[model samples]
Target: MFTRMNGIVCLTMALLLGCVASIATADEALDKAFEALKTYKWGQDRATLGAIDAAVVASHKDDAAKKDLEAKLVAVLKSDAPQAAKDFVCRKLSLIGSAASVPALAALLPDEKLSHMGRYALERMPCDEAVAAMRDGMGKVKGLVKVGVINSLGVRRDAASTAALVGLLEDSDPQIAGAAAAALGAIGSPDAAKALGAYQAKAPKELKLAAADAYLACAERLLADGKANEAKMIYMTLAKPDQPKHVRLAATRGLLAAAGQK
Candidate 1:
């Protein structure tokens, strides 16, 4: 009886060892897949990243495993990899669209190589950290970086950042100024209307479109502020034939909506 029992116990131990080895092999395969994706070769890298993402989605049932994989992904983003690779990682984090990556992504704003990518990623992020980063970067940054900052702040719809965006309406760069005006319109802040009027004065015909849209935004805010008549006037001015095509479109729609109320 003792000899038979010893043989059975040894067989069970061997089976357990085999199972453990198989699991280790699978983990190694996953790690290798992640590394291959780090090359960013497009076809192979995209495929590998897809696999990793699917694995992450499937492993949610095991909290510890999910956390471990996410930690690894964060490390990959922080690694000294090629910009292409880092870009892929940044886009992937944006795809995950969880607020968890906000802090990490915000930290990359000052990295010259990653600034544009970081801003693009932040546009998709739309969290407090992302808003704060865009607001803080606006004054000190310039050129395309500043343009990106404006775009990000606008997309986030941070009401508190409206003042900063309004300030950019006077920016020397036409693109920056125009985008800021558009953002103000998108935000629809009542306080932004006066600033937008200043923007309209200096804006060219093309830039006027942005200003016209912003006027509509200001009009909406006025309506909410119990100034429906003032909103109606601005809306009518926007719809004039002399206005740019885009401005006329915004104005016509606003006037139609207000007229319907009568």
Candidate 2:
């Protein structure tokens, strides 16, 4: 009986060793596939990065595994990789990153070529640090770069950023002003709606359309928040004869919708 038991123990140990080797092999394969993302391009004959992407990893990995993978990607962001490669990594960060990736991502926000991609990652990172990074970028960057960061902030729906966005409304650059107005509209906070309404009355004709659209968006948001009275006021402003015909018509429809809300 002792002899048979000893043989069984040996067999079990061998099987466990084999299983360990198999798992090790799988982890190495995944690592190799991820390396392909460093310089991947669309329509390539072999796109190995797809096999180890955020969606795949998230689906397969436990919390610990996911954190380990995220740390690796964050390290790649600081590597001497080409901009395109970094951009690819940034895109992946959107689906996997957390506050830990913020510093690496923030470093790219001022890069003219990479700011948009950088913000692309930051915008989707579900952490306060991400918003703070973009908010800081607002004051540090310029022109379209600034606009991109502002847009990301709006997408975050950061009510706390209302004052900063409102300040941009007076920027000399019309594109910047328009983008700020649009960002505020996307935020759709009561403060954002009020700022747009105040600016719409005196904003140049060139910026009127943006303000109008923003007003309409804010109204829809207010209605969703169960504030039909506030939404109606925005709709009323947009429906006036002075507003653009298409915008006024849209507002007219929005007005009816807001009124119908219980």
Candidate 3:
């Protein structure tokens, strides 16, 4: 009995030591991977990033580990790393990021080259900070970069952005104005619908059609939210004869939907 117990003890000790060694190896791999990621570029072997990827997968069930990884990624974003490296880090953060990742991601939003990927991560983060970051970025970027931020806000359907977006409807750049209209439509709030309605009359001919479509989109959203009366009113407006044929058709369908008719 004594000999058998000794053998079991030895086996247990060996397994424990093996586990410790494995953990040490994984930690070392993670460290090396981060170091390599600092200068990582496209077309190079992806094995370095692969290490971090595996760590992310393994951390799915471990919230603490995930947060630690997120911190590391945020650091990479703040580093003087190549844009390629930051881009890779953003993709990872999109998977495991939290509010902690917001500041780093937000800092990239005004950068024309980095804004898209930055938005890519912020868009997935379900936090008020992420929305605020994009909103703040709106004031700092212009042209297509600003438009991209506006589109991200729209995708989030952030109701808080409604007022700002409504103001953007009059931007000197038609493209910016048009994107704002589309975003407000996606938001689909009563405020958004109201804003679209107000913009329609003054909208340029080229923009009239877009504004009408956006109005229709807002009405659909209202109907979905059980605001049938409000939806019917918008549908009725678009059902007018002066509206485009397609717009009138869509309005008619919306009117029927509001009435609970087939």
Q: Which candidate should be chosen as best, given lDDT against the real structure?
A: 3
| Per-residue lDDT of candidate 2, residues 40-73 (tens digit) | 5555435576556733455454777767777878
The list of candidate 1 runs beyond 4 A from truth reads 1-26, 37-45, 59-67, 97-100, 110-113, 204-206, 217-230, 240-242, 245-253
TM-score, structure 1 vs. true: 0.75
Ranking of models by TM-score: 3, 2, 1
Looking at model 3, residue 47 earns an lDDT score of 89
Model 3 CA lDDT for position 80: 92
Once model 2 is optimally superposed onto the true structure by TM-score, how far is the C-alpha of residue 79 displaced, in angstroms? 2.1
TM-score of each: 0.75, 0.86, 0.96
Model 3 off-target regions past 4 Å? Answer: none
Q: What is the alpha-carbon lDDT for the whole of candidate 3?
A: 0.91
The true-versus-predicted C-alpha distance at residue 167 of model 2, in Å, is 0.8
Q: Model 1, 151-258: lDDT tens per residue?
A: 777777667878888777777788998878877766665566667766666777667766777778778776766666767777777777877787788777777777
Instruction: Summing lDDT over every window of 10 consecutive residues in candidate 2, give the lowest-scoring window.
Output: 52-61
Model 2 — TM-score against the truth?
0.86
Query: Would you list the C-alpha lDDT of every candidate in the order shown?
Result: 0.72, 0.85, 0.91
Better of 1 and 2 by TM-score: 2
In angstroms, give how far residue 80 of model 1 lies from its true place.
Answer: 1.4
lDDT of 3 by residue, 145-199 (tens): 8999999998999898898899999999988899899999899989998999899
